[model samples]
Target: MPKSLWKIISRTFFFLLIPIILFAEVSGLSHSMMHKMELLVLQLGVIIFVAKGMSILFEKIKIPGVVGELTAGIIIGPYLLGGIPLPGFEHGFFGTYLALNPGATLPVSPELYGIATIASVLLLFMVGLETNFSLFLRLSATGVIVGIAGVIVSFLLGAWTGMLLLDLPFLHPETLFLGVISTATSVGITGRILTERRKMDTPEGVTILAAAVIDDVLGIVLLAVILGMIPVLNDSGQTVNWGYVLRLGAEAIGVWLLFTILGLVLSKRISNFLKIFKGINVPAIMAFGLALLLAGIFEKAGLAMIIGAYVMGLSLSKTDLNYVIQESLKSLYLFAVPVFFVVSGMMVDLSVFSSRTIIFLGLIYTLGAILAKILGCGIPLLFRKFNLLGALRVGFGMAPRAEVALIIAGIGLSTGLLSRDVFGMVIFMSMLTTVSTPPILDSLFKKEKMGTTEELLPAESVVTEFSLPTLETVEFVSAKSLQLFRDEGFFINQMEMGHKYYHIRKNDIFITMICKPNGIYFESSPDDTHYVKTLMYESFVELNEIINDLKDITKPESLKNDFMEGKDDKRVDLRRVLDPGCIRLNLRGSSKKEIIEELVDILDSQYQITDKKGVFEAVWEREQSFSTGMKNGLAIPHARTDNVGAITLAVGIHRKGVNFESLDGEPSRVFVLLLSPKHKTVPHIQILAHIAAVMSKEDAVRKILDCKTPQAVYQFLTESEG
Candidate 1:
């Protein structure tokens, strides 16, 4: 699996494989119409096997699988293995099918292009399926800033490179195409690195992910807007007209925004429609159907098909059925998506290297790609208080150019907007950037205190670590950001001024953020800590780039050995208190008292509440003291009494709202009554905090409110928040 070994094995295997394929085809050339379908099948089989082998080979060597597949296309295409002349092959047309159409080049076969189009759409569709729409509802400000900065910087750099190309022999608009390519961040490549390093859920990880997703959205939209000028440029000939181009760009942006927003608005209905097919295996078929339909519609409307496909994926991402659909389409995505990349690499004519100017332009473009991400991605992290190392990690992580970039380059090539040399430049730049990112990123992350926490594990427990800067150092960075007081989106939900734990405000028994000169430490009950650590680590990833940007800590330590240290333990769980056993659906209660009484009776009978009367009196007294309603149709009627031996929950949902003297002056339809010993207030408070967080997503609340069965509500509440 070593890189050198993998390279040798792969190169040797492909060297042998291609010659055999060439020999087979030369010996058996058939232009017969009857065997066309058979030929297509043969082509697909060869591509998939070769692509898969190259993909695995590259993956083992720590390169992205997609990059391998793309390279495979180059190796097998007319440029490399395809160049071999076989006996009688000069009179045959086997090479013609694999090449860019032998006799004629213009107006390439729709059948070939159509297959590529399907592959592209499926790739985007998978991209959409994996997208987390919920991230938008509670986006980290740092991520938004980073995403915006990257898009802007990369776009400018790409455009500048294109302008440079204009000074050479390239067309004016082709520079704009380069700019569009520069605007995107390849989410898959960097995301994979973070995941592999076990840093994907950290603050930097989450921020990078959210920012990457956002940038991708922006990138596609930019591609649409830039591509829209094709018709105008085509009609106006080669003359550069700024005014006309600007008008076309504006129109493209406007149209893209209109359709994108429209798609988002209609997403809920789309999810509902798709929900009917939840148990069926046809979701993949349905997903493809939707993607293709939307792609065609967008194409007809003068935008790119991939844009429509991406939007469709985003729309369906909101549904609970999202993962299921993705699973349904896994095989097709693996087999088909690689072809788009392979075919993209196939178009890179190796003969274009004769032009030194083009090669020099490619170098400039690569610089643009590299600097744009580091400056664009890192600057945001620095401002957000991430130290330089973390910023660099993210910057490098976002450095690679893959699917989206390839798609843009392909568009430019097909539209006749870019010369063959320019296309080669784009591919070369992509290949260089893609191949360079991993080691740089690996070193950056490894340079951080990314060792496992086994050395520091307390007692008979195990811990995990993959981070830079102590937890407190992160808190210090977060505190500085909060002090800036320039909020546009959600910041840390809890940060008591100058305190240890931020958002989970009360010094909870579950998890605590500690301030030590050495660094910030997170503590939890010895019996339970893994889930809490995971939650905190995810929050850190939400912090985005603090390690890369954080500075001026009041009390900071090297924290080389203390990040994420913990014992193997299970933390207190809200699910323990709020499960199906104590849950009621479609309650007939007409009043707050009625609902509470009925819920208490269920807890007393099924939940083993021995002192039922005493517990009821304690809870009812608390309810009378003040309405437990938190408004938005939710009420937490909680009480602490010795009568309750353990913390327990009784939840009821009434279709008809009950008047609970709510602060919002609305009837409450959902009630969660908590009963616990007076000493266990921390767990109660923690559960309340979780409930508050869950309710922040109005859709979560709506789903709970509409659940007709207790099991549905329970499932909705307990599923991983991620």
Candidate 2:
């Protein structure tokens, strides 16, 4: 069968299954025991697809993907489209499970919730591993003041708002829960924005991060206290036992601090222990297994599992294994994180909003939440080195609450401390804060220096930077440096594969290397600067030696012939960028320069080239150094210059071959001209490589030479790969 026909039939079958699935749901077939697994599969598919689509739309509008994922869940949740009655599911496909009580907090099934819980644990674990332990300590003084102040103020405002708006007594469980939830902020969200703005190493950025870390710690402790209070407060009407609550909160803090300190202290030993399992995968998996075990222990100890997971990650954050574990678990993170966010959103029951009072409470509560963070976190900065603008930046930075807030609110709803109406209000507040933070933070920091000179401290780590002429040279140096490190008995860890980032350690000596597009950066101790420079000088000397050796044995004519005549197993589609109007069936030019001029004129006539004469000159300059003419009747003339706006192509054929100074001393019949903007030149090399590989086929060249019209030639090229 034809490929096109098969594609159409397959698409038709897929479209036809949609109605079948819907009919099955309507007929109650999906509710059967045998189809339960099928239902879960369908639910996952819809969740992932819709989540990605909504995330893309939100990202286009400059909002975070997390907010979009939440929006996706709300749209498809049981309270809205997911609640429409089907045959057996009177409340729709994703409706609340029958096993739960009427006023249950969760709308999805217990199994899905379980998955989301696991995802949350993993997400927290990843966050912990990525935390900068050294930087946290360096900025802890300011961070502590900002973080504590923010938490206290936010909690008071949130609790007070609940009491005033709901006519509840002070210290009510709902009020306390509200206060606890308000104290939490999303570290991931804040760090992402700072990193995007290139302010992560700045004074305000580091301070915000430090404060965020402390915020998480304090928030978790407060959550533990509230959880302890819930049972006692429920039994006694606002008559709480202060002694037991304080002790419980103290115990929680002690446990957290003890583990955190021990983990940081033994991080090196733990890293060495994990290194027993060779390769990145095993060690990474082993580290994650430890995280899971710790999480379970935390749960057993009557704390959130995420707390244990966070401790384990923080312990490993300072180790050499940190980046390796993060890189290995990336796929798992991508798969699970979205599930957690979407499920959190799914718990939002919009039915509560039918009450005008609930809507009013939500709006008013959201306003209070916003004000609480701004005042709470910002005020502490004024006492330090921050100006009003800096204080505002730090305050806005901490205002956006996300993952931790949801986790706390989930605890409230599950334990029956918070009603569904109040839960919806919490979700409303989280969404608004998260959605509004980025643009506001971005606008405030634009071209403004918010920190005093005395407070803005440089990082302690000594950095050695090198600027290179090209990306290829940087990559070459990086590879050579890795080998040199290995030769010197250093352990090498590739943190990010695509970016060519590496972390190498040998006993007391530790170094980090990163290869950017235009340069390489090295980070090490101050005492190791000389050692680093020595290694770099050695690399340059070795490179120079290699260049000198090549000069003695190189033959330009032989090399050109070998490159052009070489056949490749791979095929690339060149027809997509090749316009039909750019092809010439017959060439009137009989010389090399004339053929190039003819092709340039074709590009100009098609309006693909801006500066036609400049482009022609650029291509000729490249040709003068070495002939583009190959062994066969083929020639590829290309140039990257400012004359072209984008990658453009023009092809011409000469029935009567022209003298193009071919390597094999033969005439040229086929000419392919390529041009690209100098600023955007990466694709230029790729297309040139593709043309050299594809045109090596003698039979393909013969067929192209016989083509009578531009349309036939274009079609043949397009279908050649297929």
Candidate 3:
């Protein structure tokens, strides 16, 4: 049989067996034992397929693949598409032979339960693995402060809300336990948002992350306390046992501390030990087994299995083996993480929403969740001098409850503190927050520019200062400046008049510029003197040749470099060598073609051209069929072509502007000429974006307009990079 035909036949058989499996499993008779066994195999296979398919679909939509997996469960679960209902054959099946009858009272299959438990534990462990300890350490202090404040505020709000909303007596045990649930911050949701936004390293992001971490710690403690309190609260006539409460607290803390220390120590040794097993073919499986072992230990200690998984992650994080472990776990996470989510969705009772009470609870939960984080976390920022809006933004940023919320809800359900209604409500809240965050953040910071002096400028006392732009800052800079560098190191050195500068020194390259600034006096040691001078001299000569070529073609008297005695006589300042380089050539022509041709002639004459085999092979400009005059009377004409070294840039000032189609459909006044090497121009392109960003600033553009010499333009680009 052809491969395609065989695949079709396999799929057909699988589909056909779905009904057969369902029927045999549902049947309670002895004769259908074989069918029941076959059904089990088929069900597992089908569920896995459905789950993986749904996960892929979710990934395509940019939602977590887990969401899709859960949706898959709903499709195959009893709540939606009914499972097969076998009425007989229970006795004949192996399940019946083993005395494991499939009566209605059998509930869910034990195999399914076991799979779910394993998946849940592994999922939590993966979450632990992803935790960035270095980031946590860097932001530890602020994070702890912010996290604690947020947790306290949210917890208080939740507790208070529960107290006010519940009709039960103030002393009721259930109400208190419910309050504890309300106080929990969904770390999972917050972590996802932090990761997605790439704000995991931001002060605000780090704080939120750290706070969530601490919140989980405290939240678990609170849960234990509340659970313990339940018996006391319910026994109205009995006195509370403070000793037992203290003992439980001590035990919990001792266990947490012991595990944390053990994790820290074990993490140090993990890399070294793993090295010994380097020749082992299944390192991933080994790492996973370790995670399982740790998880089991934590569970045996009466702690949450997820806690153990988290500790395992924390332990491994300190080792070089962390990345390897993370990589190895990717397959499991991809395959099994979705199972947890799907199981979660399968457990959802959709009909619960029809009840007014359930709906009301969900509403209350959502409102409380928002208010809790905002009031809890946001209020403290005011004390730190953040204005109301800033504080609100911070609060709202931390509001969404996700992974942690689900985890907590699961635990609550398993422990019997929360019923299905509460679990469902929490899930609903988690979804609401997760969906609302991106838009909320987008609106809050949409027009907010990054890399302002406040963010980039170093403190006055610091001898050297540097700034790392936020993603928003990078975007703004890219839009406005002609060239930008991200995370590139820059060094500046000043040499005395007679001192020799070398380019070979490891760090002595003078005038080392990365992103925006163009020219400044750079200091280099004698060793690096040659390389630095060569780079600078070559760049300068190349630029000048371009200018001279342009002047030759245009032949405008005003564009000539000759110095006139009175009005035209401008003294050339060598000090301007320390500034960014700029050159402007004026071209006068009757038609656009004449002007462009003259421009091209200048490039061909000026720059030394090298030929290479590739996509962009020669110097040429395209009209782009339209002018790129985006706004503010500026025009950008750019072209990509052959083996050009570095970046060849030219500027033209058309006294009477050309009729290039602007974005506003207006004529352009300024023409900015750009030529990039066909390949390896990504760096040059970044620089061009930086320049555009600079020009987007009205002040910066005006400064460019005031300049007359090539030296002046050089000053702007060089100094800006600084």
TM-score top scorer: 2
In order of appearance, the predictions have TM-scores of 0.57, 0.86, 0.56
Worst 10 residues of 1 by lDDT: 560-569
TM-score, structure 3 vs. true: 0.56
Residue 31, model 2, lDDT: 47
A best-first ranking of the candidates according to their TM-score comes to 2, 1, 3
The sequence of per-residue lDDT tens digits that candidate 3 reaches over residues 1-722 is: 45654575467547745555556545344336575456455556666676766655555555655556656765655445434333443332112322453332222344554676788777667666666676677657755777777667666666566556555554455455455555555556555555555555555665566666677666666665656566664455245677877787787678877987877766656645655665433655676677788778766765666677777777766555555566666777766666666666655656777799877877887788787877887777666545666566567777776555566666666566666666667677766666666457545544344411134222222111123333333333322221211112221122222222211111112233222222223333345546444554554455568679986787433321111111311232223222123245466754455545554444545642354222122222345433445555566566666555546655555656666655555555555556666546345444446545545555655576667866676666555543
Model 1, range 1-722, lDDT digits (tens) per residue? Answer: 67776676667567545544555645655567755655455556666677778888888777778889888877766566654655534422225554446533312234545677789888887887777555443446767888889999998888887776656323346777888789777778877777667676555676777788768877877777666555555433465566876776676667667866877788757756765674556655876798899889878877788878887887776654565567678778887888777777777777787788778888888988999999998877766657777677778878888888888788877777777788889888888888888778877777655222122212332332324454445556445433331231111234333444432211112233444334545444565466545554555665665555565442222321121122212343567776588888767878877888888887877854778788888889878866677657777788877777778777788877888876668888878888778645457666655665555455655788877788887777776343
Candidate 2: TM-score?
0.86
* lDDT over C-alpha atoms for residue 106 of model 1: 17
Candidate 2's displacement at residue 434, Å, is 0.3
Colliding pairs, model 2: none
Q: Which model is ahead, 1 or 2, in terms of TM-score? A: 2
Off-target runs (Cα >4 Å) in candidate 2 are 1-36, 86-91, 96-103, 234-236, 459-463, 483-517, 523-525, 541-577, 584-598, 609-625, 639-648, 653-659, 667-669, 674-722
Q: Give, for candidate 3, the lowest lDDT window spanning 10 residues.
A: 560-569
Residue range 358-461, candidate 2, lDDT tens digits: 88888888888878888988887777877888888888888888888988887787777888788889998889889888788888778566565365776668
Global lDDT scores for all candidate models: 0.68, 0.81, 0.56
